[model samples]
Target: MISKSTIDKVFESARLEEVIGDFVQLKKSGSNFKGLSPFTDERTPSFMVSPVKQIWKDFSSGKGGNVVAFLMEHEHFTYPEAIRYLAKKYNIEIEETEQNEEQKQQANDRESMYLVSDFAQKYFEDILWNSEKGKAIGLSYFKERGFTDDTIRKFGLGYSLDEWEAFTKEALDKGYSLDFLGRTGLSIIKENKQFDRFKGRVMFPIQSMSGRVLGFGGRILVNDKKAAKYLNSPESDIYHKSKVLYGIYHAKQSIAKEDNCYLVEGYTDVIQFHQRGIENVVASSGTALTPEQIRLINRLTKNITVLFDGDAAGLRASLRGIDLILEQGMNVKVCTFPEGEDPDSFAKKNAYEDLVLYLQENAKDFIQFKASLLVEEAQNDPIKKAETIRDIVQSISKIPDRIQREVYVQECSRIMDISEEVLFNTLAQLGKKNVAEANKKFKKERKAFEVVKKEQAVEKIDVQYQLERKIIEILLLYGNRTEEFEDLLLKENEEGELVLEPELHKARVFEKLYLDLQQDEIELSNENFRTVYYGLISKLNEDDSFVIESYINGLDSELSKEVTSILMEEEKYDLSDWEGKDIYVKDKAESVAQLVGETILNLRCFLIDKRVSDLRQRTLEKKDGNNHEILEEIMNYHQLKKLLSTKLNRVL
Candidate 1:
C-alpha cells in the first residue's frame, strides 16, 4: 500500500491546471480554468479546474476529483499507476514496496486490460505500416479514402492478413496473452477453432472515451456480398457497442475546446470531418444513440450538433436522438447536408473553413429543425398535425431545465404554427407526468440506497457511532476550550521586579477532552475521525496550525460534510461572544494570557481528578508505602479538586 506521507506529498505538489492542461487546452475562466472534457466528444468546454482547491470537475459528465482521480479517469490508470505516473512526471522518487513475481503477474484488472488494449492498438498500427500485405490492402484503402498517412496513423487504422491465424500467431509469439487478445476481440476462438477475428479485414479499433482500445470494428475489403460488411467485437468486460462512440477518445479534448460535439452517424463520417480539421466530432458508428453514448459525450460537452446525411435522411435518422438529447439536459442542434450528400463527401468537397461555416449556417435548434421538416408531412390533416405537435412538445418537455424547455416550447409554437397556450398546456401535462415517473423511480432508488446504507452500518457498528459523536463534537465545540492550569507563582527578584511563572500550566479542552477519553480507555470510534484526529494531533505536535479545509479536501463527501458540519456547528457555539459571563475577562495581554493558561490548567486538573476518583470508586488502591503517605496523597488530591472547582466556578 502507498503510505499516507507519499499520498499527501503528491497531492500537495500536484498543480491542478498543469496536470489537467496536458489533455485539455484551458484558458482563464474566472479564478479557475475551463476546457473541453477529455472524457467526452464535444465542441464547447464545460470541464473546470480549481487550482485553489486542487480539484477538477466536468459538469457535463458529473465526474469530479483531484489530479489523481483525473489521471485514473482520463488515462485509465489504477491508483498506484496514477501515483507512479505523477511521481515520474514531477520527478519525485517513489518509495514502493517490492512486489513478488507472482503478485506482479496476478490477473489484470480493468486498467490492465486498457494497457493491454493500447499495446495491441500500437502493435496493429505497426502491422499496418511495416508489413507488405498491409501496405497493399489497408494502406491503399485508407489512401483511397483520401486519408493522409498522418491521419491514418493518428486514428491507428490497421489490417489483418487474409491468411487465417497470421495476426493471431504473431500476437501470441510476442508474449501477449491469448486470453487478453480474445477479450479485446483481436483474436477469435471457436470449438477448437482459433484465429484472428478480423482476418482479411481493415481494422478500426474502437476506443473507450479515454482512448483505450476496448474493442474493434473491422471492414472486409474482399468483394463478397456473402460476408457481412462489418464485424464488431461482441460485448466483453470492457466494450459495449450500444454505449460507445467511435473517435470519442481522439475527439474528446477537441470537443471540450469547441464547446460542442459534432455527432455523425458513421465511422467514415467522423474520419472525414476529422481529417478535414473538424476535430471536435465523433460518430455513433451507425448504432442508435444509447443513453450511455450520449452521457459519454455529455462528459465532454453539453452542446451537441448532429451532422445529418441530408435533410430528408437526417430528419428520419435524428428523431430518437432529438428527444433523448433534450432529455439529457443537452443543447441539441441539427444540421442536414444537401440532398444525396453526407458529412464524409461534403467534407471532402469543402475546405475546413467552408465545412465550419456550412455547419454554422445550416444548424437549427432541434425543435425548429423538426417542425420545419415535418410540418409539410402533416399538411392540414388535423389528426396527423396534432400528433406532430405532440411529438415536438414531448421533446420540449424532456428538457431537464425549465428555461430551456420554455425556449424550445416557444420555438415549437412559432415553427408549428400552433397556439402558444395550447403548446404550454400540453407541455405542462407531459412535464408533470415525466416528473412524477422520475420521482417514483427516485424514491425506489433512494429506498434501495437506504437499505445498502443500513447494511453498511450494521457491518461497522462502533465505528459509525464514534464517527457520529466525534463529528458532532467537532462541529459543536472546536474553538471553545475549557482551560485546566491553576496557579501563577510570583517571585520578587533582586531588582524588586516580580517574576511570575505558572506553578501549574493549563491544557486546552480539546487536549483535555482527548486525554480524558484516552484515560477512560476510550478512542475516537469514527474511522475517518480516528484517521483525522491522529493526523491533526500529529500535525499540531509538529507545530502546525490545524487546517480543517485542507484535511477536508482529502476526505470523501460523507466525511467532508461531517467535517463541514463540525466547523459550521462550532460557529453556533460562539466562542468570542461567550465572554460576557464575568468569567476569565482580562484588560491586558498578560492578563489575557494568564487567564487562558489558568483555565486550561484548571480543566486538565479536574479531568485528572475525576479519572482518579473513578479509578478509586471502581477498584480500591491496595498497597501503600505508609498509611500517612496515602492519607497525605488523599489530602493533596482534595486540594487539587477544590482548586479545580474554584477555577471552574470563576471561568464558567
Candidate 2:
C-alpha cells in the first residue's frame, strides 16, 4: 500500500494539463484546455481539462474525474496502480506502509496478474542478455531476423530458457506465488508440478497503450515440424488478444502525430517498419483483424492503410477487414508489395525513401482495391461479376458517413462499369433489410418494457433526474459561499385570509440548501447522487476550512467521479469568444444565491407535479364515490404550483 503522504505528493506534483496532454491534443480554451474525447470518436472537442480544479470531463462520454481517476478509467488501472503510475511520472518516490496478511491478500486480482506479468517480462529479458543458452539461441534468432540491439531493447524483446523449470524456480525463490504465475500463464501446472510455459522461445512482451505489460508472445526457434512456431499467453484477467495490438505502446504517439496507421500482419513486420522509419505501424500479430482492433486504431487516427503480402491468399484474407474498418467510420486504403514479398521482407529489401515512395504511389482507396482484386476472379462469368458488384455495394453500405459512402458508391460504379442506379438500389435494399430487422428487435424489447410497466408504475424519471442533478451541481460548486435568503411563513391578516410573508436571513449556501430540503422532506432519487450529497453535508458540518480537493480525495473513486462530473458539466464546450469580441458575460459566482434558490425551487416543483399526477390517477380510478377529497387536494396543489412558477418567472 502506498502511504497517504506519497499519494498526496503525487497529486500535488502531477499537473492535469501536462498528464492529459500526453494522450490528447489539447488547445487553450479560456481557463481550461479542450480536446476531442479520447474515450469516444468525436469530431468536435468535448473533453476539457481544468488544471485549477485538477480534474477532466469528457462531455461526449460523461466521464469526469481527477488525474488518478482519468488513469483508472483510461488505462483500467486499480487505485494503487494509478497512484504508482503518477508517482513514477512525477518522479516521486513511493513510501509504502507495511501490510498485514489480510491487507496483502486484499490486493486486486487483476493487479496481481499485472505484477506477475511485469516480473516475468523483466526475468525473460535478464535471461536473454545474461544466460549462455538464451544468448546463443534466443538473442541470435532476433539478430538473424535483422533486429538491431536498439530495436530489440526498444520493444522489450526477451528470451525464455529451454529448461522447463528455470523461470518457475527463480520466481518461486523470489517469493512470488505460483498461483499468480499460473494465472498469468507464465507457469503451467501439470499434476501439481510447475514449469515455464514459454520454454525455448524468444519472447515478445505485449503491452497496453500505457505501456504496462499485459502478457507475452513467444516464438519457438527450433525447426521441429510438429511444434507450433508461435505461442501466445492465454486470455487471463489482463490480456485480451482481440483488444491489444502489437507495438501499439510505441506506435501510438506517431500514429496520432502522423494521423495515419500502417496495419501489418506480424510482430516482425511492425518491428521492421519501425526500423525503416515508418513509426506509425502496428500488427494484428498474425490474428485475423477484428472490430475491436479497428476501434483501437480509430482512437488514434481515422485513416488506416492496411499493408498486405502480395500473395493471393493474403489479399483474400484482408478483404473482410476493409468493410469492418469502414463500419467504424474510418478510412481504409490498401497497399500491396511485390508478388513474392511480405511487409517484413519488403521493408528490409527497400531503403526508407523507396519504401515510403512505393506506399505513397501504390496505396488505393477501398473501392478501387476491392474491385481490382475481385475482377480477375469474376472474368467472363456474369453471375460472378454480379456477386462481386453486390459485395462492393455491401462494403460501401457499411460506411456511416453519407459523403464517404456516396463517394465510394460512385467509385464502385465507375470502376465496375455498373449503373449508379442499380448500385444505389442494392444499397437501399440492404438498408431496408437492416431497418426491418432492427424494428423487430425494438418491438421485442418494447414488449418486455410494457410488461415491466404493468408490474409497477413507472415514474417520469428524466425531468426529475435533470432537476435533481441541477441541485447537486449547485451544491457541489458553491455550497460553502454565504448568501442572503428570504424565509417565507404563512400568517393570517386582518382580512381573515392566509398569506405568505417574508423575513430576511443570512446563511451559508450549504445551510440554506439543507434546511430547505429537510423542510420539504425531500431526498435525491439517484442513490449515487444522494450518497455524495450526504457526504458533502457531513463535510460542511464538520470542517471549518473545507477544501474541495481534500474532500474529493477522501471519497471513494465512484463518488469522486460523480462530484467531478457535476462540477464540470457546464464547461462541456468552449465558451463563445465573447471576450475577444468585447462582450461581457456574468461570472457564475455573482449570481450564486439566485442559482441555488432556483435549483431548490425547481426540485420542489418537480416533486409537487409528481404528487399531483398520483392524486389525479387516484381520482380517476375511484370515480364511483368518495373522491371529492382527492380532487380538492389536486386543486390546492395546482394553486401551489402556480406560486412556484411565479417565483420562477414562468406563467402557468
Candidate 3:
C-alpha cells in the first residue's frame, strides 16, 4: 500500500485540468475549462473542469471527480494505480510500507500481472541496450529500418536474446512467479521447461491509455521462413488486444489537441508518423478493425481519417472500417497513399510538410470515397449499381446524428446520380426493419423491466431522505459558520400547565445541528449520510475554520464522491445564463440560518408524521378494544407534526 503522505502529495501536486487535459481538449471558459466529454460523443461541450476546486464534472455523463477519481473512472485504474500514475507524472517519489507475508498474499492477481509485464519491458530494453547479441541484431534491425535512436527509446523498443531460458532465469531470480510470467505471456513452459516467448525479437511494448505497459508486440528479425514475422502477447488478466489500440498512449494528447486522429495499420506505421511530427495517429496493430477500437478513438475526437495504401487490399480494409466508424457515429475520412506504398513506407519517403499536404489534399469523406470506389466497379451494370447504392445507404443509416446522415445522403444522391427520395425510401425501410427487430427484443424483456421499475419505485427517495440530505449538505457547506437560531420547547410553568417557551441561541452551525438532532432523538436514515454527518461533526469540533478539501481527503472514495456530488451538482445549472440575464443569485451563506432551520423542522415533522401513522396502524390492527393509548400517542404526534408544519409555512 502507498503511504498516506505520498498520496496526499500526489493530490496536492496534480491539477485537475492539467491531468484531464491529457485526455480531453479543454477550452478556456471563464474561470473553468469546458470541453466535449471524453466519455461521450457530442458537439456542444458539457464537460467542465474547475481549476480552483481541482475537480471536474461531465454534465453529459454525470461523472464528476478530482484527479484520481477521474483516472479511476476514465482509465479503469485502481486507487493505487492512479496514485502511482500521478506520482510518476509529477515526479513524486512513492514510499510504500513493506508488506508481510499475509499482506503480500492479499495483492490482487491483476496487479501482479501488471508488475510482471512492466518488468519484462524493462528487461527487454536493458538487453537491447546492454547485451552483446541484442545490440548487434536488434539495434541493427531498428537502425536499418530508418528508426532514429531517440525514436527507438521513445517507443521503448528492445530486444530479447535467442537463448531459450535467458529471460526466464533472470525473471525467476528476480523473485517473480512463473504463474504471473505465464499469465502475462512472457515466459512459456513446455514439459516443465521454461522458455522466453519473444526470444531473438525486437520488442515494442503496448501500453494502456495511461501509459502502463499491458503487453508487448515483437518483430522477429531473423529471416527464417518457418517463423512468424510478428508476434503479440496473448490475452491475459490485464491485456485485451481487441480493447487496446497501439500508440493510443502516445497519441491521446495530440488527438485531443489536433481534433483529429490518423488511423494506420501497423506499429511501425504509427511510429513513422510520430517520427514525422504527426503525433495524432494510432494503429489497429495489424488486426481487423473492431468497433471497440473505433469507440476508443470516439472518446477523444469525433473526426477520424484512415490512411491506406492506394491498392485494392487497402481499399478493402478501408471499406471494412468505414461502416464500423459510421456505426460508432464518428466522421471518418480516407487518405490513400500512392500505389504500392503503405503508411510506413510513404511517411518514410516524404518530408513532413509534403506528407501533411498530401493527406489534407487527398482526404475524402466516407460517402465520397465509397461512391468513387464502387462507381467504376458498377459501370454499365444496373443491378450491381443498385446494390452498391444500397450498401452506401446502409452505412449512412448507421449514423446516429440525423443532420450528418441527411447531408451524407444528399451527397450520395449527387454523386451516384440517384434521387434523394429513393435513398430516403431505402433508409426508411431499413429503419423500420431495425425498429421491428428491436421491438421483438423489447417485448421479450418488458416484464422483467417492469418488475425492476416497481422495485426501484419502492426504493425511491422518501421525505426523510430529502430532509436528511439537505441537513447534511448544509452541515458540509456551512458547518463552522455562526448562526442565530430560535430554540422552542414545551415546559411545565408555575401553574402546572404545559407551555411553549422560545429562546434565542447564537451558535455555530455544527453546534446547532448536533443539539437539534440530539434533542429530537433523530438519526440519519441513510448509512452513508450518517457516516458523513459524524465526520462533519468531528471535523468542525477540531478545526476553527472549515476546509472541505482537507475534510474530503480523509474520506473513503465512495463517501468522498457522494460529498462532492452534493456540493457540485447545483453548480452545474449555476454555470448557465441565469446570472448574465439580470437574475441575482443569493449566496448560501446569506441564507444559512433559514436553510438550516427549515431542514431541521422538516425532518422533525416527517418523523412525527411517521410516528402518527404507526400509531394509527396499531389502532387498526388491535382486535382487543385497547385503542386509548394508541389514540393518545397518535394525537400527540399529530399535534407536533402540525406545529412543525406551521413553522415551515406548510398546511398539513
Candidate 4:
C-alpha cells in the first residue's frame, strides 16, 4: 500500500491541468482551462480544469474530481495505480510496502495482465542489453537501423530469445503466472505445451498514452520464409490494436506542444522520426487506420500530417485514412518521400534539419494531394475524371464544420478544374444519401425498450433533492468562511402571531449551517449528500483552515465525485465570459452568509412542505378521527413555512 505521506505529496505536486493537458489539449479560459471532453465525443470543449482548486470537471460527462480522479476515469486506472501514475508524473517518490504473495495474487485480471506485460517488457530489455544472444542479434539490428543506445532504450526496444520455451520457462521460474503470460501472448500454450510467441524476434513494446506497456510488436531477424516477418500481441484485456498507436507515449506532449501529429504506417517509421528529433509522430502499427486511433490524435491536435512512402500503391491504399481524419473534423496534410524510400529510410538518410525541412516543404493539403494523385489516373478519361471528382466531393462531405466544408469544396473545384456548381450539387446528393442511410440504420438498430424509454414522460423536479444538493454545494464552497448572518428568531408579535425577528450574529458558515440543521432536526435526503455533508462538517470542525483538495482526496470515489460536481457547478459558467461581455457575474463569496441562510431555509421549507403534505393526507384518510390534531399540526407547519418562505422571498 502507498503511504499517506506519498499520496499527499502527489496531490501537492501533481497539477491537475498539467496532468490532464498531457491527454487532452486544454486551452486557457478565464481563470481555468477548457478542452474537448475526453470522456465524450464533443466538437466544442466542455471539459474544464481549475488549477486554483486542483480539481477538474467534465461538464459533458458529469465526471469530476481532483487529478487522481481524472486519471482513474480517463485511463481506467485503479485507485492505487492512479496515485502511482500521478506520483511518477510529478517525479515524487512513492513510499509503498512490498506486496505479499496473497496481495499480489489478489490483483484483478486486467491488472495482472498489465503486470505480466510490464514484466515481459523489462525482461526483454534486460535480454537485449545483457544476454549474449540478445546483444548479438537484437542490439546489432537496432544499431544497423541507425538507432543509438539511448533511442533503443527510450522506445524500450528489446529481444526475445531464439529458443521456443526460453521466455516461457524463465517467466514461470520467476513466479509470473503462465495464465497471464499466455493471455498477454508473450507465451503460446497449447495441448499442455508452452513456448515463446516471439521466438527469434526483436521486441518493440507498444505502450498506452500514459506509457503503460499494453503489448509488444516483434520483428523476426532471420530470413525464414515460413515465418511472418512481423507479429503483434493478440488482442487481450489490456491491448486493443485498433485503439493503440505506436509511440503515443513519447509523442503526446510534442503533438500537443506543436499542435500537429505526424502519422506513419509502421513502428520503425515512428521511431525513426522521433530519432530524427521529430517527436510528434505516431504509427498505425501496420493496422488500417481506425476511428479510435484518429480520436487519440484528435485529443492532442486538430491537425494531422500523414507521412507516406513514395510507393504509389501504398500511398493509394493509405488515402482512405485521410477521409477518416476529415470525418473526425481534423485538418490533414500528406507528405511523401522520394521513390525507393519510406519514412524510416528517408529519416535515416537525412540530417535532423533536412528531415524537418523535407516534411515542411513536401507536406500538401489532403485535397490538393488527393486531386493531383487521382488526376494522373483519370487523365484523358472523362468517366474516370467524373468519378474522381465525386470521390473528392465525398471526402469533403466528411468534414464536420460547414465553413470548412465549403472552403474545401471551393478548393477542390479549383484543383480539379470542375464547376463549383457541379461539386456542390454532388455534395448535396451525398449528404442526403448519408442522412437517409443513417436514419435507416438508426431505425433498424433502435431497440423496443429504448423507444419505450423515450416515450416516458419527463421527471418532475425533486425539490428535496435540489435543496439538499444546494446545501452541500454551499457547505463545500463556504463552510470555512466566517460571515455575519441575519439570524431569524421566532417570537410572539404585538398581534400575538408567530413572527420572525432578524438578529445579527457572527459565526463560521459551517457552524451556522450546522446549528440551523441541528435545531430543525433535519438530515439531507440524498444519501451521497448526507455522507459528504457530515464528513465535510466534521473536517471543518476539526480544522479552522480547510483545504478542499486534501479533504476531497480523503473521501471515497463516490463522495469525491459528488463533492467535485457541487464545487464545480459554478465553474461551468466561467467559460461563458459573461463579465467580458459587460454582464457582471455575482461573486458568491460576497454573499456567503445569505447563501448559507437561504439554503438552510430552502431545505426547511421543503421539509415542512413535505410534513404539511403528509398531514393533509392524514386528514383526508381521517385515520382514527385524528383530523382535529392533524389540522392543528398542519396549520402550525403552514405558519412555519410562511415565515421561511418570507425570508426566501417565495410564495407559499
Q: After superposition, how far is residue 152 of candidate 3 from its true place, in Å?
A: 0.8
What lDDT tens digits, residue by residue, belong to model 2 across residues 215-247? 999999889898789899999889999989999
Residue 103 lDDT in model 3? 78
C-alpha RMSD (angstroms) for model 3 = 3.4
Clashes of 2: 0
Model 4 residue 362 distance off true place after TM-score fit, in angstroms: 1.3
Give per-residue lDDT, candidate 1, residue 186.
Answer: 70
Tens digits of per-residue lDDT for model 3 on 1-652? 7999999999889888888888776777657777777787665678888787677788888787778889988887888899999999999999999878997887788888988998999999999989888889889888887999899999999998988889999999999999999989999987769899998899999998889899999998779999889999999978889989999999999998888999988999999999999999999898888987887887678899988876646475458778888887789998888888888888899999999999999999988888888888999899989999998998999998999989998999999999999999999999999999999999999999999888774456678877888888888778898988888787778997555577888999999999989987888989999999998898899988777776776778888777777777666664574667888777777888888888888777778878888888888899997999889878777766766777778987
Sliding window of 10 residues with minimal summed lDDT for model 4: 617-626
Per-residue lDDT of candidate 1, residues 1-652 (tens digit):
4666676777667787877765566766545677666666554566677676566667567666667777877766777777876776678777766677897787466655666677767766877899998888889998898889888888888887888898778777877777777777777878787797877888888876545678888898978988888888878878889878999878877887788999988777888888899989998887789887887777656799988877444466568887888777789999988988989999999998998899999999887788877777888889988988998887777787888777777877777778889999998898689889999998979988888888774454443353345433432234233454445454666997445444655665356445545654655445766765665555445543545435655676555545444443322222233445555543322343344444445445545565567655534555643456555666666655555555456532
The deviation in Å at residue 76 for candidate 2 is 3.2
Residue 579 lDDT (model 1): 48
TM-score, predicted candidate 1 vs. hidden true structure: 0.69
**Model 2: runs farther than 4 Å from truth?**
16-52, 56-64, 349-354, 379-384, 433-458, 462-471, 480-547, 571-590, 600-646, 650-652
User: What are the TM-scores, per candidate, against the unseen true structure?
Assistant: 0.69, 0.82, 0.90, 0.97
Give candidate 2's whole-model lDDT.
0.86
Number of clashing pairs per prediction, in order = 29, 0, 0, 0
Question: Which candidate comes out best when scored by lDDT?
Answer: 4
Kindly indicate the candidate among 1 and 2 with the higher TM-score.
2
Candidate 1: list runs displaced more than 4 Å: 1-14, 18-50, 53-66, 73-76, 83-100, 107-112, 311-317, 432-523, 527-652
